[model samples]
Every structure is written in structure tokens, then in C-alpha cells.
Target: MSRRAEHDVRDLVERARAGEARAVARLISLVEDASPLLREVMAALAPHTGNAQVVGITGSPGVGKSTSTNALVTQLRRAGKRVGVLAVDPSSPFSGGALLGDRVRMQDHALDAGVYIRSMASRGHLGGLAWSTPQALRVLDAAGCDVILVETVGVGQSEVEIAGLADTTMVLLAPGMGDGIQAAKAGILEIGDLYVVNKADRDGADQVRRDLRSMLALATGRDGAWKPPIIKTVAQTGEGVDEVVDKLAEHHAWLASSGELERRRTRRARGEIEAIAVTALREKWGDVHGRSELDTLAAAVAAGDADPYGAADELLAAFTD
Candidate 1:
């Protein structure tokens, strides 16, 4: 990068660390766009990250994930905490852009200086998150957000990937959603740090809670493992959200006292590193002229002229060369 571009990135980082929302947004845009300055941006922001609590909210469609996130933000801000929200929406195939539905739902905080809300498109990426989510998260973390809420696309079963990225993974369910059985089928029971039964004003809410408790009882855990708490909430009315925030704090405390915070962060970092490395290798492989080595090897394997392992070895050898 030229000196002017380098200076601009430094200025952006400074503004972001000083709680400038536009600077934070620009940095995240760089991440989403895969800008050439991404490396410089990340290097500048690295020292300011790792402070925000990343809470992931995920569940099936119509489970009130967005409403619950908004309620949580209200409660957090009431306590004087600076909050950031990244709502990952399904990408529009025609436009390849976020539908911005989550942002619309969260307009109550639009004027709040203590809050920054961004909508990211999943862009056909699976696992309920955009591929660039972790890097976007670093931008928010470096921007002095006390808490970051990552509300994922309501992709049901595949949404469990949020557990790997969040410091606390909250799985939201509602009455009449078949959530009790669906939770088990989706494997969310294994990943949730907090289970919230939203829309509790409706009938069958207690039964859903009872069924969840019974199911959780059957799952085995190591001694002293933090038991996931199931909280009931009517997120639309902001009822029971305070208790949810309290449980989040307790979970955060346990994570610190048990040294699990460091372990989880380390694992998160390892995954980020692996993802970056794999993406780089794929880009390198795609750089070959006309027919790449991978394509040549794939053709040979398909023709039964070479075994898969041998072809893979040849590809790796070509890379090393």
C-alpha cells in the first residue's frame, strides 16, 4: 500500500478505537469486500481486540431471535454498556446483498450512540453465518463494544456453527415451534450455553420448558461443567430479558473462573488461522494459468488414470515446487 493508504488505515483504526461508528463500519466493509488493505487493517486492529463478549443468538425461523437480541441490547445499554450487533441475514440471490431485515427490526437503537448495528449477508455461505463474520467481529471488538451480539440467519440445523465462534451461544425457541424435539434433532442441545424459551406468554410454553429440561437431563457432562439455563421470555414486551442478561453475566464469570475463556478463545483463534491458511492455499491453486494443477489432477483421477491420494500428492508437490 502507498503511504497515503497506510496513513488512512492508521487514522481509521484510531477513530474506531475512539468509538467512531463510521470508522468501525468502514473497517468491517473492508473485511466483507476482501479489500487489499485487509491485512493492514487487521494488523492495526489486532492490539485492540479480544475484549468484547461475543454472544451468538441462533434458532429456527420465527423463534424471535431478532426481538430477543433487541431486548438484550436494551438491557445491556440500560446498564451503561456499549453494544454492537451483527445480524447475518440470508443473501438475496438477485442482488447478493443483505435484505437488511434485521436492521429494520432493530431501529430502536438506531439513534443510540452507545450502540452500533450492522447487517451482513450470508452470501450463500452455510452454517448460518457469513464467511467474513469472525473478521467483522474483530472490527467490533476493536471498536470498544462492551458486548457484541451476533444474531445469525435463522437456518435451523446448520446454525450450530455459531457455538464455535461465540463466547456464549444462546439458542432461542418459542412455544408451538416444535422446538423441544427440533432442538434435539438439530444438535443445539449440545452447543447451547443458554437456552431461551421465548414468547412465553403463549400456551404450551411450560410444556416446552419441561420437555427441554427432561432432554437436557439425559445428556452427560463432565463434573462441574456449567449447566445451561433455560430462561423464559416474551421478547416483544421486554419481559424476562433482565434475567437472561443476568444469566449471561454468570456464564461469563464461570467461563473466566474455570479458565474456559482462555481455552475457548485459543480454539477460536486456531480456527481463524486454519480458515485463513486454507483460503490462501485455494487462492494460490486458482492462480495457475488456463487449466490449474488441481483441475489436471482432478481430470486424471476421474479418468482412473491416477488414484485420488496419488493425485493429491502431486498437487501438493506442485505447490511446494
Candidate 2:
């Protein structure tokens, strides 16, 4: 908490609140890098968060996630809403940077001041999302984005991580992507708050819709719960995009009415807190590893003198103490 550093963070927070894109981008970069001053940055931004509506879009690769996200941004902007987009891309092995392909697809919004888009690298983290997504989301929320869209890396079955981060999760599907039964097998059916069939102009689109409906009917939901709606869209031409937005609005209203919005946000916060704590513990364990205490414990376990559970407890005690 040096005076100079504190002053810099405060200035950045003020500039971000005034809607300066550079300040917002800088703040998100700090989150991504796990900066030493992260706590200060988060504290300064806390008061302005929890206002934006977050929607997550995920599916298998080639499901048109970026196109749909761009289309959704267009619709939201037309309704006079400020939009933020976080497009998570696979990390480059050498550069450790986002591929930036998704941002290229969203070039339509490049000049729109009402829209801010950032491409983040997954950095080898699983679950199809970058580790810093939640923190980046807080920055966008505090920056007065009316809606934020999170586009996952779409790494097949494990992509359900977005469900934990977004207020509304839209699982996108295309006609030839092994049909809707595969969507169920991919584990998206359980997490989606809304299902979107993109590229509806293609053949077998009706069959895709039918398969989705049939699959949804078989899957049970909470008692008196919301039934996820299925919408069709040709994202390239923006046809049927408006209906998708309308369904999103309807779902948002239902979330408020059922008190589910608060519940979801509460769960999201819980996950974020747990993640930070776990990361801290891992760092502490790394220090212990450097001391060779873990190696000593492994030797004891090898001799059958100390069981695994007890050895684990001893290692954890090294840090907790």
C-alpha cells in the first residue's frame, strides 16, 4: 500500500468509471497477470460491480460462437445498452497470448464506443475459460456495461465452466454438430438457460430444433423451474437475432421474479472466493515444496510408516501453521 501505488490505482479506477476503454483494459490486464496490487484494484472497483447482466455462450467448436456473440452485441446496442465482451481463446504455446481470432470476427463493433471487447487466452486452463475470467468480469461490471457476453473456448464436453460464471448461459448448436443428442452427451443440456440453434438457414435445422426439444423434455429440472427456451438464428445476416434477444430479456425477467438472479450471483461469488483461496494455498505449497518437506513426506509414505491422508494433513499443516 505505498502512497504512489495507491494513488495510481485510485486514478485508474476513476478513469475506468468514467468509461475510458484504456483504463478498463489496463485493469483487466492486471487481473489476468495476477498483479501484486490486485487486492487494491478489486477493493476500489467493488462498489461499482454487480450491475451488469452477464450472459455466457458456449458449445462445440465451429458452432459459430463468435458470430452469435457479435450479433447479440449488435442487438443489445440497438436497444441503447452498453455491451462488454470477453472472448476466451486458446493460448499460444510460445507467446502465451490469445489467438485474437475471435476479436477479429467481432470487428463490426471496433468503432462503437458503447461496446468494449477483449480477447483472453485460456493459458492451458481447462473448462474452456481463462482463469482470470471472473475478475475480468468484475472490472467490466464496474465499468457500467449494461450487458457482458462471455464466449468460451468451446473445448467440447468440459465447456460447462461458463455456467458457473454467467447469469444466463446460452448453449449454441449447429445442425451438423452431431445433432442435439450429442449436445446432451456433451453436458451442455444441464447448464444452459437458453439454447440457440445457429445457421438456421441450413438444411436439417428443423431436425436440430426437434432433437433439442426432445432432449430437453427428457431432462428433468428443479420443481416449478424455468424451462430453457430454444431459439433459431442466422447470425451472419442477423435474421432471427432479435427474437433471441427477446428471449434473453424474457429469461432475465424470470430470473428476477424467481429470485434466481440473486442466487446465481451468490453462487458465482462463492466460486470466485474459493478459487482465490485455493490459488493462495497452491502458492504456499509451492514454497513448502522448495523446502523438500513434500519429498520427506513421500519417503515416509513409501516406507508405509505414514499413510497418504496423514501425510497430506502434515503438508497442509506446514502452511496453516
Candidate 3:
């Protein structure tokens, strides 16, 4: 990296550590853009990471995810915790930028110095999260956030991806949103650490909670499994949100006692490392996509002169050798 670029990163890191929001924002922007300086940035931030409690909130659109996130921020802040929110929005087809609807919904904390909120575009990456989320999360962690909430785009089954990244995953549902069946179909039953029925003041709220409990009971849980708690909330009024925070605290204690906290962090780190390595390999492979050796191997496979497995081996050999 150029000397000037290195100095920029150092300045950003220092400012972010001092709780400067704009510097923190710029560091995350570099991560979102996958800048060439990302390696240096991560190295600088590594020592300060692993402190924030990551909470992932996901649900189908209109299930009040943003409202719940906003409420959670309020609750956590009242407890004197610094909070960070990453609201993943679907990318615009033409601009590849976040639609910014999530940001609009979360304006309640817009002026709070203790809270940092960012909207990230999914950029067409599946699994409801932006490919850049974990990296962006590192920025927040290093910026001294006590709690980081990741609100996903809530795009069906792929939304379960959050379970792998967060320390605790909260799945939100509503009374009239077909939430019970939708939860089952989206595989959320397996991923949720806490099941929240938002808009609980509405009709059929009890039915939604009952359905969730029924489904969870029938689901075969592993030995010593952590049974997800069901919480009801009218996020618009912040009703029942304190209970949710209590449940989160209880879950965090349980995770630490059961040694699951360390295990989960280890697994998350493994996935992040593997993803980075795979991306590097893809970049290398992209340069050789139309190489003569690859074309010849493709022709051989097409002609039945060699099987797909054999062609794949040959292609890999070319890349290695």
C-alpha cells in the first residue's frame, strides 16, 4: 500500500477508537467496497475485536424488524451500552446501492451519539446478508460497540445465514404475516435462539406464540440444546422490549456457562477465514477463465473424451502448476 493510504487507515483507526462516528463510517465503507487496503484495516482492528455481542434479527418484510431493532437499541442504550446496528437492505438493480428503507425506519436513534447505525446493500448476495457484513461487523467491534445488531433483508430461507454469524439470532414474526408457516418453511425453526412475536397487541398474537411453541416442541432438539424463548412485543410502543433484553442477557450467561460462546466464536472465525480464502481463489481463477488450457479441457469434456471429474482435476492442475 502507498504511504498515504497507510496513513489514512491509521488515522481512521485512531479516530474510530476515540469514538468518532465519521471515521468509523469510513472504515466500514472500505470494507463494503472491498478495498485493497482491507488487509491492513483488518490487521489494525483485530486486537480490538471479539468484545461486542452480535445479535442478528431477521424476519420477512413488514414483520417490524426495523422497529424491533430500534427498540432494542433504546433498551440496550438505557443499560449504558453502546450499540451498533447494521441493517442489510436489498440492492437496487440499477445502482447496486441499498434502498435505504431500513435506515428510514430506524430514524428514532438518528441523533444518538451512543448508537451507530448503517445500512448495507446486499449487492445481490443471497442469504439476506451482505457479503461484507462480517467485515463491517469487525469495524463496529473495534469501534467499541458493546452490542451489535444485524437486521437482515429477510428474504426467505436464505435468511438463516445470520445464525452462523451472530452470537444469538432472534427471529421476529407477526400475527397476520403467515409467520408460523413461513417460519417453518424458512428453516428459521432451526436457527432462532429467540422467537419474537412483534405487534403482539394485534389480534391472533396469542395464536402466533402458541403456534411457535408447538412447532418448537415437535422439533427434535439435540442433547443439552438451548430451547429458544418466545417473547411478545409491540415494538411501536416499546412494550415487552425490556423482557427481550432480559432474555438476551440470560442467553448470554447461558452461552458462557455452557462454553458455547467460545465454540460459536471459533466456528464463526473459521467460516470467515474460509470465505476469504475462497474469494481470493475466485479472483485468481477469474484471470484464467478463458485460458487455452481451460478451453481445451472444456472441449475435451464436451466431446466425452474426458469425464467432468477428470476435466476439473486438469483445470485445477493448470492453476496450481
Candidate 4:
């Protein structure tokens, strides 16, 4: 990198570490845009990361996820912790940008300097997150957030991906959402570290809680495994939010004492490294739009002149060369 560019990145990192929201936002934008300077940016911020506790909140649509996240942020701030929120929203087809629905709902924190909220477009990536999310998270972690909440694009069944990314995954369910059945089908039964039945004042809330507890009972775990707790809350009214925060702290403590925190973060890092390497390889092979070595190998395979394995070998050989 140029000396000027390196200095610029250093300046941004310093400002972000000092809790400047604009600097933090700029760093995340660089990640989202896949800027050429990303490597330098990541290096600059590396030492300052690994401090924030990441919490991922996910659920089916209309489960009041935004409301719950807003409440959670409110509670966290009341405790004097710096919080960062990454709200993954569906991409707007016209503009290829976030719809800003989560940001809109989270307006309660707009004036708070200690809370930084960003809405990211899913951008057609599957598993309920933007491709840039992990990098954006590093930016937040390096920005000195004490706790970071990732709220996914409520894509239903495939939303369980949050489990792999967070230190604690909180799954939200609501009465009248048929979530009990959907939870089983979506594999959320295994992913959630804590489950919240939002809209707890509704008529069917008790039934929803019972169903969730029974389903959780059926899942077997090793000795000393943390039993996922079910908490009921009316997120709009901030009811029962303190208990949720308390549970989060309890879980974080368990993670540290049990050494699972290191394991989880290591796994997260491995995934991030593998993704970066794979992306680099794809870039080396060149884009699909142009006639590249991959296109040639694919053509040979299609014509039955070269088997897929052999073509793949050739591609790897070329890549290695």
C-alpha cells in the first residue's frame, strides 16, 4: 500500500478506537465494498479486536426481532456498556441497498453516542447475512464495542446460520407464528443458546413456551452442557429484558470458564480465513463473465473430452503454476 493510504487507515483505526461512529462506519463500508485497502485496514485493527462479546438474534418474520433488539440495546446501554448493532435487512432490488427497516425500528438509539447501529443488505447471499458481515463485525470489535448484536434478515428456516457466528445465539419466537413446528424444521432447536418467546402477553404464549421447553428437552447433550433457557418477554414494553441480559452474562461466564469461548472464536476465525482464501482463489481464476481457464476446463468437461476430476486437477495445476 502507498504510504499515504497506510496513514489514512491508521488514522481511521485510531478514530474508531476512540469511539467515533463515522470512522467506524467508514471502516465497515470499506469491508462491504471489498476495497483494495482491506488487508491493511484489517491488519491495523487486528490488535484492538477480540474484546467485544457478539450476540446473534434471529427468528422467523414478525417475531418482533427488531423490537427485542431495540430493548436489548436499551438495557445494555443502561448498564453503561458500548453496544454495536448490525441489522441485516433484505436487499432492495432497485438500489441494491438495505431496506433500512431495522434501522427505522431502532431509531430509539439514534442519538446515543455509545450505540452504533448499521443496517446491511443481504445482497442475495444465503444464510440470512451479508457476505461482508464478518468483516463488518471485526470493525465493530476493533471499534471498542463492549457488546455487539447481530440481527439477521428474518429469512425463516435458513436463518440458523447465526449459530456459527455468535458467542451467544438468541432465538426469538412468538405466539400465533407456528414457530414451534418451524423451529424443529429449521434446526434452531440445536442453535439457540437462549430462546425468547416475545409478545408474551398474547393468549398462546404459554403454549409456545411449553412446546419449546419440551422440544429442548428432547435434544441430548454431553455432561455439563449449558441448558438453554427460555425467557418470556414483551419487547415493546421492555418487560423481562433485564432477565435476558442477566442470562447473557451468565452464558458468557460459562463460555469463559468452560474454555468454549476460545474454541468458538477459533472456529469463527478459521471460517473467515477459509472464506478469504476461497475468494482469493476465485479471483485468481477470473470472473465467470469472461473466457478464463475455468471456462475452458468447464467446456472440456461438458464435451466429454475431460472428466470433471481431471479438469479440476488441471485447474488446480494451473492455479499452482
Candidate 5:
């Protein structure tokens, strides 16, 4: 939160590769802040970031996300890559504690020096992903992880936002899941840089794959690009896990050759900036206008003195100064 503290965090971050869990924890906290100090720390760490292959995985609840993540971690570890996972879960609206403890599902990675798993709760954020996810990923990226897997909380816009944040977005859908198809309607179908039909051992696996392939076949991308590959995975048995990872690497290679990596990176950076800016604006406005101001605005609306849109416009006017 302060200048000296951020510097200390940088030092600790460097040591995190040496198995300094304390340093890793500290770096995570520092980046989670909205202070200028945080921005500076992130900037200083920027040169060291972007080395990790950021893979975002999202899908329906019954899609076996935890199982898939575990299998993916195993495959990555076999390749001798240091891996970090940010498991995003939703917090209770009342208690503000995560309802699903990610650690419970991911205990195998606990003592793995090559594997780092951190669970984050949404804390009632509407976006499905936690507010601090970007900086959190950056921290892991700078910590010398070769591959970072971000698992989004299975929800609507949050999952889409998670896809936007990844270098390769893998949507995990189960077989015969009509609900999964419905979830795809929220632009998840389009945002996927890659797709995974997990739980493929189940009935109707081929049908789901056919549906996805057909859907992808019908769509024309920005440049009439090749259809993103759909990999079937039975994570519970480690079936087709390596194929999924291979497809991810394939996408990255394609990104490098097609000159799309730079453009995608630029777009993702802008999205992160915008998300931070909106977050800052909300925090600042709340601080500037306190409860009294909000109450006044509410009363004005009730009295028909100020319309809701005009009241929001009033706040935007304040942000200008």
C-alpha cells in the first residue's frame, strides 16, 4: 500500500521462485490494492510479466472444472513447467466467505514446488471473477511460473471476462448439457480461443462435439479465421488431457505467426485498464459522496427531482475533475 512496502514486495517476488511462500503471499496482497503504489509496482514488474502462457478455463458447473484443472496441472508438470492456478469462486453474499473452498478440491498440489494454487473469492462482485484477478495473475506471471491457469467461477459475464483475460480461453462443457449450450449464448461461444468438451466419457459426448464444431463452422471470424479446435477430455481419467494442452500450444503458435498475438495482447491490456479505471471511479465516487450524498440522490429520485441516468451523469461529471 505504500512505496517502501511495494519495493519490499518486489524483492520478495524475486525470491518467490526459491520457494518463499511468504514473499508470494505478500506480492499477491500488494497487487490487490488500488493505490498508486500498486500501479507503480505493477509497472516495475511488467518487464518480467507476460512470460507465462495464461490459460483461462470456464464452463458449466457440472463440467468437471476441478478435475480438468488437476489433469491439466499434471500434464504441465510432466512437461517440467512451473504452474500457478488462480481458482476463482464466489463468496457468500452474507458472510463474504467463499462458499466452495477451492483448496479442498485441489489438495494434490499443496506440497508441489512446481505447482502453486491460490483461491480467490468474488466477494460479491457481479463479474463472477474476483476484482483483483488481473493483478493477481500478473503477480503469478512475474513469479517465474511458466504456465498459469486461471479457472473462472462458473457464471455468466464473469466467465466471458475471464476468457478475455487469457491468452487462450478454453470453455469446458459437459456432454448432453443443454444448460451448457444456454450458457454459451452469453458470448462464451464466441470468446473461446479454444474449446474443451470435458467429461467426454459420458453419453452424448459426440453430439456436444458435433454441435460445437457445427456452430464454429458456421461462424466467420474477424478475418475468416480457422475454426478453433474442440478437444474432448475425460479429466477424471486423464484421457485426452495432453491433446488439450497440445491444442493450446497450437493456438499460441498460430497467434505468433498470424500477427494476432500483439493485437490480442493490446486488446487485453486495454480491457484490464478499463476494468481498473471503472473500479477506481466507483471507489472514488463512493468515498467522495458518502452515504449522505447517496441518500440525497435517492430522495431526489423519489421526489422526481433527478432521474437515475442524470444522477449517474452527475457522478461522471465529478470524475472529470
Candidate 6:
């Protein structure tokens, strides 16, 4: 990392903990670039990370996930909890930048001392989160926020990546999502620690709730020791906000009492360590091998003078050796 970035990251982290909003925003932007200084700052801050309740909210598009997230953050603050929200907006495929629509919905918390919200672009769109993003989450955790909510970029499907990263994974669905329990198949049912039927004021709300309860009863017979609760919410009205927060707190407490909290933190730590190693290797590879070699290989591949797999093998050999 550049010395300037290093100094800036450290100063900004302290400022954020001191409740400097702009400093926190600037620090988040800086870390998104994956600098060496970010790794250092986060490592020093890691001890403070596991204290927060990492809640992930996901669902089909337009089911009010972002609105629900905004409500939950507000409710958390009302309950005296410091909160941070990570809204993963889809990146513009052409520009490679976040669309930020969800962030716009969360702007009410911009100046609140107890709330911090950031929109992350899914690193590989349609695949998973970016490698550097979760490390950024550790930074927020270190800043002393007691609760962190992550909004995954997807419509109805569980965000497997966020589910893996968060302490509690919630799948939010709307009234019309479906009735048959089989509709929850395909990498979706396994991740949710809870199901939220958002927009409960809409038509067919009762049907949605009944369908979800039936589904949960069937799922309870399967494997998980803890049954994921189903909650109804009218996010626009903030009606069920407190209930959601209570549910989150209940799940967090259960995890702690059952010793699952230690296991989850261990998994998070392992993921953080692996990301740091990958980042360090890529940096060394770029510095020692340089971009010129990559450009040459790319040209050869484009000209069909070299096979893509063969070129990749050559790059892999550099690290393996």
C-alpha cells in the first residue's frame, strides 16, 4: 500500500469510530480498491469484528428487500443498537459500477450516528460477491456497530455467498411468489435461517403466510435443528420492523448459547484469512511478473497463437513454483 493510503486508512478508521460520517464513507471507498493498507487496518481491527449480528436479507426482485432493510435498521437504532447495512446493488454490466438504487432508499441513515449503509457491486455478476467486499465488512464491524444487515443482489433466490458470510440469513418473498413448497427448491431453501413475507399489506398476504408455514413445517421434518421462523412485514409502513429485529436478536442469542456463534466466527475468520492470502499473492504476482507479460499472453491468445488454458497454466506455474 502507498504510505498515503496507509495513513489515511488508519486515520479514517479512528475518525469513523469517533462518529465522523464523511470519514467513514471515504474509508469504505478506499478499502474497495483492495490496497495493502486495507489488509493491515482490518487485521488490527479483526478483534472487534465478531461482536456484531451479521444479518443477510435476500429475496426475489421488487419484493421490498431494500425497504425492509431500511425499516430493520431504523428499528434496531430505536432499540439502541448501532447498525451498519451493506446493500449489494447490481453493477452496470457495461460500466462496471453499482447502480445504487438501493442506497438511495437508505439515505435517511446518512447522518445518523448509529447507522452506516454502503452498496457493494457483486464482484462477478450472476456468480457471487467480490473477494475484497467481505473484508470491508470487517472494517464496519470494527467500527463498533452492534448490528450489520446485508442485502444480496438477487430476485427470490437465497444469496448463498451472503448466507455463508452472515450470522443469520433471511429470505424475503412477496405474496405472489408461489404456494407449492417445491417452489423453494434450487439452492434457496438450504440457506435461509428465516423467511420474511414482505409487503404483507398486499393482496394474498394470508395465502402467502399459510403457504410459508406449511413449507416450514415440512422443512422442520428434514434436517436443521433450528426451525427458521416466518414473519410478515409491510416494510413501507415499518409495521413489523421491531418484530424482525427481535427475531434477529433471538437467533443471534440462540447461536451464542448453542456454541454455533464460535463456529460461525471461525468460518468467517478462515474466509478472511484466505482472502488476504489470495490478495497478497495477486499483488506479488503483478509486481514481480508485471502486466507486460500478461499483455503479451493476451495478444497471443487473441491471435490464436496460444491456447487460453495453456496461458493460464503458465501463470499458475509462477505461483505454484
Candidate maximizing TM-score: 1
In model 3, where do residues sit more than 4 Å from their true spots?
Answer: 90-95, 101-103, 124-131, 154-157, 222-225, 289-308
lDDT of 4 at 270: 77
Query: How would you order the candidates by TM-score, starting with the best?
Result: 1, 4, 2, 3, 5, 6
Better of 3 and 6 by TM-score: 3
State model 3's lDDT: 0.82
TM-score of each: 0.92, 0.91, 0.90, 0.92, 0.87, 0.83
TM-score, structure 6 vs. true: 0.83
93-180: candidate 3 lDDT, tens digit per residue: 3464555654576788889999999877655332224246788899999999998998875444256567788998898999998856
- Could you give candidate 1's per-residue lDDT for residues 39-155 as a string of tens digits? 898898889888899998888789898889989999999989899998865434345455555457688998998999987765533222424788889999999998999887545
| Runs in model 2 lying further than 4 Å from the true structure | 90-95, 101-103, 122-131, 154-157, 289-292, 295-307
Quote the positional error of residue 209 for candidate 4 in Å: 0.8
Q: What is the C-alpha lDDT profile of model 6 across 105-168, one tens digit per residue?
A: 6777866878888776545422235465576577677777898888875543336767778888
Q: After superposition, how far is residue 201 of candidate 3 from its true place, in Å?
A: 0.9
How far does residue 220 in candidate 6 sit from its true spot (Å)? 5.7
**Model 5 lDDT tens row, 263-286:** 777878887777777776666766
Q: Name the regions of candidate 6 deviating beyond 4 angstroms.
A: 1-7, 90-93, 101-103, 122-130, 153-158, 178-186, 220-224, 282-314
Between prediction 4 and prediction 6, which has the larger lDDT? Answer: 4
| Whole-model alpha-carbon lDDT for candidate 4 | 0.83
The local distance difference test score of model 1 is: 0.82
Give candidate 4's TM-score: 0.92
Which candidate, 3 or 5, would have the higher lDDT against the true structure? 3
